[model samples]
Target chain A: MLERSHIQSTGFRNVGPVGERTGFELRLRQANYRGTRLSLIEGVTITVDGVLYPAAHNLVRIGSRVYTPAELDAATETRLAVGEYMTVIVPRPGGLAPGVHWVESAIGYRHPYFPPAHQSAVARDARHATIVMA
Target chain B: MTGFRYGVSLYSYTDDLGTVMTLDDAFDHVADTGATGLEILGETSVPLYPEPPAAWLDHWFAQLERYQLEPTNFACWVDTRIQLDRKLTVAEGAEQIALDLRLAHRLGFKFIRPKFGVIDYNLTPDPIWEGAVERNLDLAQALGIIILPEIHAPTPIHHPVTEGYIAFIERTGTRNFGLMLDTGIFQDRPLTAWGGGDIEAIRKDAPDMVNGIKVPVEHLDDIIRYVPFIQAKFHHVDEDLHDHQIPWERIVPRLKALGYAGYLSSEYEGVRDPWVAIEQVRRQHALIRRLEAEWEAQHA
Candidate 1:
């Protein structure tokens, strides 16, 4: 079962190696009431400790596949169903000093059903998550 | 006199379904309200959707039998704008409906509400909707189902969008198609909290959606014959049994006057604060049932 909030706390960690960390990743449960095709997700922006990482710089991983912002616009076969979460990979060399940090995510969604002006909806969430290991 | 049938759409439990509440918990909540019908979203409520495991299917029937609720409407999506650059063709749309029709039959649902994607802000469905639905008339009839596209708010009962639907029913003379009334259209007051989506942006771009379109209740008399089900969409009902948004007082009388004996499925789009919908749904049932009782007393 996923958490109630859009931003999940369990999947918060740094990737690559101990000394030469490549980046950090966090999970986000789909915020919409219904699951959307991957193409419908415009982008997901990540911000940590006030440092910003725009949606373009973040790569989303759903299941075993990773997708860029442009790829997400064309990937129609993939779906993040209700109660499912995807990990947002933000590239930041040497990650963060192993500790608790304030993290936020802004996910842009293009729902064709919504009116033209309101089609691009952004779901934002912020919370404190701990990176246990360096 | 025949009174209205009461039910609840699983949509009322939007945020809490997967978090704090389970499917069993939802059944308990609705049955406790004395509602005899249960409405569910095909994609949202059905695990694995189009193809749930046999075990889940067994569990679904078991839940229905135990809760003493009958399946009402199977809510679905046409997704006309399937991708950013492309839209689904009429054939694809027909296939979508056919798939849901079969699934709804398996789940013992009488109605399927396919929310077709819109062409513009007026929420006019794509042109392919007609052709798509035209092809599924036989299948819907065979399965004993009615395809109901909701007459929701911001899109009033008199708009060209609704006229198009009525025209289709008149032109084809098919009993398998009808309009599902979403009571939100008759909302005469402003909504404080919208449970659907981004509220502030909706208020700025489409004020009619948030501020209410205020379609008159008398309009129900215009097309009540074409309507067989109503989604009781409401935002808030206070501790004192007062609905702050939708005006059921005017609407209920019109429905009763029309001799409509269909389900009033609670479609709660309100504050997503966990269990607030449970009590709000109960309040709506109480308030609407009281109005029905009052109408019966007057006539009898």
Candidate 2:
């Protein structure tokens, strides 16, 4: 008999009845602007389950329907017309967490709250000075 | 005996008082907050540099009276880097202490809260420490004011420095020396947030590090017997207010039961909006007033 390890595959979104009567909040971030890094995801059209979620304050939203950009299968159309919005229907199979899990930017890397630890530059300078003195 | 009047320390509103508040504005603000007194910072609030003129002193007292707020204290610090060594020499520390006393006397402050250098500075409480205390008390007594050494963070009540502080006062046998116990020593943050500043950093390296800092709320019973002034410190939360991380529900009652008539200042540190923060101080003030009334109702 071989011992087996149970592996749980959890995805980007978690969809279920909100616990404690409070719905979970999720952020829809635009990571790809065709290699052009810019704030305000300008001229980006977004939708959640065919409902129009306008990009305002660089964020688009559907009431209680949390969706991320990764969840949207991009169409050949690169840009929406001026004052035009995109319409994409919710995938029949996709929902929230337990419904879908989208890949995120490399985790455990470059988290602003976790700054990289470095040796003191002053201490290094002091050591060099001492070496020069010697 | 008139109970020690409530006051606001300028350090309590470092954001507003440091920038927007002038001495006159501070008096007005403290009075508006219903505080009976004010504690002005030496450099920031008092005309310490180039000496405070007699006319300036007179104007300060007039402003204080106009707002009906007494000058309770002047918080004084010594720039030890200029005077160096872990502790200041008795003569050196005394010079600064005497300045605090003179300023207090001039501005009509009955008390002076002096920061006894940084926590690490007085770790072992050496002879220099004793010398500083002796000299400060002497200067304060001569000036007819009480010099209070504040028991703040990085030093617990039971720390040797605190015990040595009490011993120094008792040994000197001067009525002009005392303690200012800041309630922040008893505060508790989430274990994950202890020193990491992350509020989410769980240290697998050291299990006990989570509860690394303790402020001696249990020893508050011992320390309160000697408390002359209290930094009635209120942050956004009270959980981080003490060494044992004392919840005010327990600590406040204990202080009241002890008949602590010391000044309880409104030290609000909620970093939102000025109006909102002031409102917070008011709410806490109301809570304290109710607590004091309840205590009096029973004890009186």
DockQ of each: 0.66, 0.01
Identify the candidate with maximal DockQ: 1
Instruction: Give lDDT: candidate 2, residue B186.
Output: 67
* lDDT on C-alpha atoms for all candidate structures: 0.90, 0.49
The CAPRI category of model 2 is: incorrect
Tens-place lDDT digits, model 2, residues A1-134: 10010011211232234332211123222121111111112223323333433333122233333223432212111221111122222232223333333221110111111111210001000000000100
Off by over 4 Å in 2: A1-134, B1-4, B48-50, B53-55, B83-88, B119-127, B190-216, B237-246, B270-276
- For model 1, what fraction of the real interface contacts is kept? 0.58
Best-matching candidate per lDDT: 1
Model number 2 iRMSD = 24.4
Distance from true location, Cα of B44 in model 2, Å: 1.4
Query: Candidate 1 regions off by >4 Å?
Result: none
